[model samples]
Target: MEVVKELKVPIDYLFDVFEQSIQSDILAQTGKKLNENEFTGFEYVKDFSKGNQATIQIEKYERNRAYYYSTHTDKNKISVRYDVHSLDEETSKLHYSEEIISNGFLQKMNDALVGLVWGFLKKKRFKEMLNQIEQSYTE
Candidate 1:
């Protein structure tokens, strides 16, 4: 999945907001602290509901420009990337993409069917979150 959006905030601000969000989420989920200065190649395990867990790795980290990561689970490997471009002094473009690879035939089939049903909802929610971020920054 891929999404692109124009944000009403500078690239630096957007990147900082995104980094803080990720750090807080990781800390909440895994009880781990992330050092922003050494974010690249950082790895941690995050626990989910129902005792599920996944290993998350920071694959690429470029301040104010790009952040890419991968999550490895027993059933799937998921990669996500966020790229930010400055359009002007107070505007930026954000490009987001996500890919998932299933480890087995059944999981692949299930993922396809579930993605067909839930993909739009997920995208909508993500866009809403971005909008909220922009609104907060602008205010």
Candidate 2:
């Protein structure tokens, strides 16, 4: 299953929110915590090094993008990549996409379930994130 979402926010402020929200100890402000039965939590595992594959769990953010590795209790790992586009110094667009590979049956099921769940969850998260960005900067 592939999920995509986009949001418009201030470039600098949005990056700041991205940095803060993905902190190791910070639960996603969106509050979409994974079930402990499926996955206990996430952690920053690896990053873009000299020449190697990057890990998903965002340990720390430097430039504009953050990667997070979500691990399941069964040891399944998936990468969630966040791409930020600066429309202007004060405005930016955030695009997030995730690819979940599963069996044909499970994939179909995921597609159906995710349609209902992801839309609600992703939109809610994006709105709250934009609000936080605006608040962080305006105040």
Candidate 3:
């Protein structure tokens, strides 16, 4: 899945927001504080309801440009990337993409059906979050 949005915020401000959000999430999940230099190769486990958990690793990090990460779980491996491009001094384009790979044949078949519904909901929620960020800057 992929999405692209033009944001009203400057590239630098958007990237700062994105970076701070990730840093806050990491600190909340792992109780470890990390600076930008420590982002690449950092690994942590994120727990979900019902005891489900995934190990997340930062695979790529480029300040104000790109952030890519992967999550590994028993059933699937998921990769997510966010790329930011400057459109003007006060505008930016964000490209977001996610890819999921199932671990087994049965899981793959099951994911095909489940992914459709979940992906739609997830995309919607993500778009709303982005819109909120954009709105915050304008306000």
Candidate 4:
């Protein structure tokens, strides 16, 4: 599943929100208490390093692109990739792609159903995020 959001703010601001959301998710999902650079399971690879973990790893990130992966196992996995495009100094386009894979006949069906629900919820969260971004900048 892919969703595109055009923001009135600059690409830099979008990336700021994106990074914060992912970092927050990492802490939430892992259920571990640690600093940003410290993690019990999550590892961040920035420029030259390669990701080898099977679950919860930042595949890569640069100024305008970021790819993230999280999986319970080979049977259940999801990847979200972000590619940011600048329309001007104050406008940007965000391209997001999400892939959810589940093994077993029953699991696949269940994942599909869950994905459907999550898609709507994801959109709502995005709206809140954008609004929050605007509010934060305004204050």
Candidate 5:
């Protein structure tokens, strides 16, 4: 389950907007929709690290950075890695690939379906989040 999306904004304002988006409550809302009760944050630390025990939390956001995190699946203990890459200063690409531990056709199908639904939700949520950020600049 690999989902990718790209968004373009002004190069000069991109970092500012991106930083604000990450620090804002909008990210928390997105996290709630993406992860579960067990892991619901944008950053994982040494003390709070879930290790390789199947976490569903987002990684820390470095300045002008990209990150990947493995999080528990919504249905099972299976975990998936969400990878993102910041392209240029104005564009960014996101990839949410569902990691399949089991090599079964059924498992693949399940993961694909989950990815589809998650992808749809992500696009909607990201668009809404961006809109909110833009609105804030005006206010």
Candidate 6:
């Protein structure tokens, strides 16, 4: 699955926000609903400022794109990439693509049964991250 949004910030600024968000608990709270504990390993990293947690990795970074991967303990993994396309010096389009992969039979069943809700929650988190970046632009 994939999620995309148009952000009104420069690509450079988006990268900065991403780096900042990872360093804090913002990423730990990504895709967080009112009371869900489905996501793990995003918090408590020894050096999240570098974006490598127990189950998350940030890589393939360039001027306009970055890839992030996160895994749940039960063999469910999410690989997502952010592509930023500059429209002008001050605006850019953010395209987020994600793929869910699992090697466990239980995980596959879970995905088939609750994937839609999970996708919605993840999309909500992506928007929240964009909002965070936009807010930081004002500050």
Off by over 4 Å in 2: 1-10, 24-56, 59-62, 65-68, 102-118
> lDDT tens string, model 6, 33-93?
3211222233333334555444454444554565354544445667777777888888878
- Residue pair clashes in candidate 5: 55-71, 56-71
Q: Scored by Cα lDDT, where does model 5 land? A: 0.49
Q: Estimate each model's TM-score.
A: 0.94, 0.51, 0.93, 0.67, 0.39, 0.67
Q: Candidate 3, after superposition: displacement of residue 137 in Å?
A: 0.7
- Which rank order by TM-score, best down to worst? 1, 3, 4, 6, 2, 5
At residue 119, candidate 3 shows an lDDT of 84
User: 99, model 3: CA deviation in Å?
Assistant: 0.3
In candidate 6 the C-alpha lDDT for residue 114 amounts to 79
Per-residue lDDT tens digits for candidate 2, residues 17-132, read 55454542334332444332322234433433564432344433434554444432222344455666676666666656555544467665776687688877876776676566
lDDT of 6 at 30: 52
**Per-residue lDDT of 41-65 in model 5, one digit per residue for the tens?**
4533222245333334544333344
lDDT of 4 by residue, 5-109 (tens): 877778787777766766677656565454434432455422223634445666656655554555545566777677778899887787877787787889999
In order, what is each prediction's RMSD in angstroms? 1.3, 10.8, 1.2, 7.5, 8.8, 9.1
How do the residues 1-139 of candidate 3 rate in per-residue lDDT, one tens digit apiece? 8999998889888878868987998998999989887899999999999999999999988887999999999999999999999999989999999988999999999889888879899889999998898898989
Show the colliding residue pairs in model 3: none
Off by over 4 Å in 3: none
TM for candidate 3 is 0.93
- Candidate 6, residue 123: the lDDT equals 76
User: Which candidate model has the greater TM-score, 2 or 3?
Assistant: 3
Which consecutive 10 residues in model 6 have the weakest lDDT in total? 32-41
**Candidate with better lDDT, 4 vs 6:** 4
**Residue runs of model 6 more than 4 Å from their true location after superposition:** 23-54, 70-74
Residue pairs whose backbone atoms clash in candidate 2: 56-68, 56-69, 57-68, 57-69
